[model samples]
Target chain A: MNGYLLAGTITGVVVGLVIAAVAMTFTKKNRKEKFTYDERQKTARGEGYKYAFFTLVIYNAAYGIIDMSLTKPWTENMTGMMIGVCLAILVHVVYCIWHECYFSMNEEPVKVLAFFGIISVINVIIAVIQGLHGELIENGMLTNNCANLIVAVMFGVILFALAVKGYVKKEAAEEEE
Target chain B: MKNLKLKAARAAMDLSQQELAGRVGVSRQTINAIEKGDYNPTINLCIAICRVLGKTLDELFWEE
Candidate 1:
């Protein structure tokens, strides 16, 4: 209905196509014993999913309890609350990717940084361009561009911190060996 | 069952973890985990490792 939905739909389609193509190509090749799933990766994936599921359950329960206490129906804004589920999925995906349990995506530090860096860059570019073009609602108690800027900065900081922590831990691990 | 014998056997054959993993069609982390006793590999993987190292199940996995 809006530009946001249109862009999201396009992005989703592109990503889905890429994923399907990769699956079709790799499934046959990987059917033979070619060193894919290892014990460590399997364990990591299991642990990641377990933790994510548990967290999601706790989150949903907390929200439900809060809704009951307030006597306000929570289903009125399902789209807003769905962000929690999206975040839970992000947590699981990040954990799996961190532990090298993801399908074919190596957990190289540079690659990880690059992936997050690209997201951050896109956010910043969009926000800045909107601001420069006078698209931001000026009365500013959190306009759309203002919100975009906040998200861009927040994710940028988080990504930077993750990259640093990963680098430090990797260095410490290498030093230990 | 840490399977040090498996590590030793692989080492005796002068194969790195990655190399042995390649031969057995598993990842190096799997080999490392098996050696470190952090993971219990399936029988199929055990057999594959044995075959690659020219070892038997009893020789590499059975603990005394």
Candidate 2:
């Protein structure tokens, strides 16, 4: 890599870390009003965690086996690990959403949904830019640039699930009325 | 079996599931699940519901 590019990357990462730290501090300050899950929701969340853990274990095992058996790995280490983590997160989110335990007492669903929407859009844009640059794949193998694409897809799936669940509930409510 | 007694009690109080759940510090979905026989809440939650609805354990949650 060019020396100037390496320096610029390092500088950008450092600035990003500072911004993230500031955001965390602001969030912590605003979170003084704590929201808690009720018993049933807590139990459902626990089950979600269990399922997510199992997903992570199963995904990692399969990924490891595939990587070892293949002559060339499809993904780099960071990307492969991120895929597993995202899968686990997707499972957990879907389970919690299905069980109606995803949102706590004081949390606004619209805000959470908007947050996910923004994250999905940002990731999708980054992935698209990388794809256009021919960075998402190299030598017939998936590159680390695909990580953003995977994240975009994960959030997209979550948004889709939430929408579907909301639609189902609306239909059920209309039927009951 | 569905806890029709709990549903009746909640209804008698003129409280919607959302209102009752708010009073009992739970989600409406939890109350709906309990009423629908889909979820068996903990004893604490049952007690909370009973207290909110002015019912006893035997009145609301006990199997007939």
Candidate 3:
């Protein structure tokens, strides 16, 4: 309703649009027109999802207990948003590790891990900036709600970039065979 | 330095990087990186390559 909220909303939407555009461009450039999931990739993804789900449940339970002890409710929007994004990132990291381990047995794992590390640092910087500017929360419940939205967008963008790079390398190898 | 010896050996066996990768259960880029000396393969991958090429590990991996 206020000017700050309006500005945060606009910023979040713009960031989301830019990230979506970039993802589309990468997918178009690298992948085949048809979509196909390799059996190995599927199995790895399934395993990763399982890890992510367990992580989310455990984190939520622990955080909920802590919040309750502090006289805070677990149903708050800000806490929910943080938990959701953290779980999403956990899932993605698990998937990346699985895919790399299965398909790139001879390749260094540090390369993919480094990429994720960089993205995480960037996300933290953004969150800190947004929080400092008071654009992320008011009264501890995400009055603006835009910073979390931007983080979700950025997560999707980074994941898409990783997928594109992986698929491109796979296609290049297939061509040589 | 480029791995001319590896490239030559692979050519002698009529194997592309993709074929070698398939035999070794790694991505082709891993094989390409090894051939270009951009990456060093693990001991397991080295042994796999030796097995596929029917050469001793030293013959396939050692630097002269």
Q: Which ranges of candidate 3 are over 4 A from the true structure?
A: A1-18, A27-35, A73-76, A101-128, A131-177, B1-13, B17-64
Please write out the lDDT profile of model 1 over residues B1-64, one tens digit for every residue. 5777987898898999879987886766678778978778889988988888898899988888
Write model 2 residue lDDT over B1-64, tens digit each, in one string.
8889999999998999999998988888999999989999989989999888888999998896
Where model 2 places Cα greater than 4 Å from the true spot, the runs are: A1-31
Displacement of residue A58 (Cα, Å) in model 2 is 1.3
What does the i-RMS of model 3 come to?
7.9
Scanning candidate 3 chain A in windows of ten residues, the lowest lDDT window is A29-38
TM-score, per-candidate, Cα-based: 0.63, 0.87, 0.46
CA lDDT, candidate 1, residue A79: 30
Q: Which candidate leads in lDDT?
A: 2
| A71-173: candidate 1 lDDT, tens digit per residue | 5443333332453565566567667656656543222445445555665687689889988987554432223334345446655765755666568658956
TM-score of chain A of 2: 0.84
lDDT, each prediction: 0.66, 0.85, 0.62
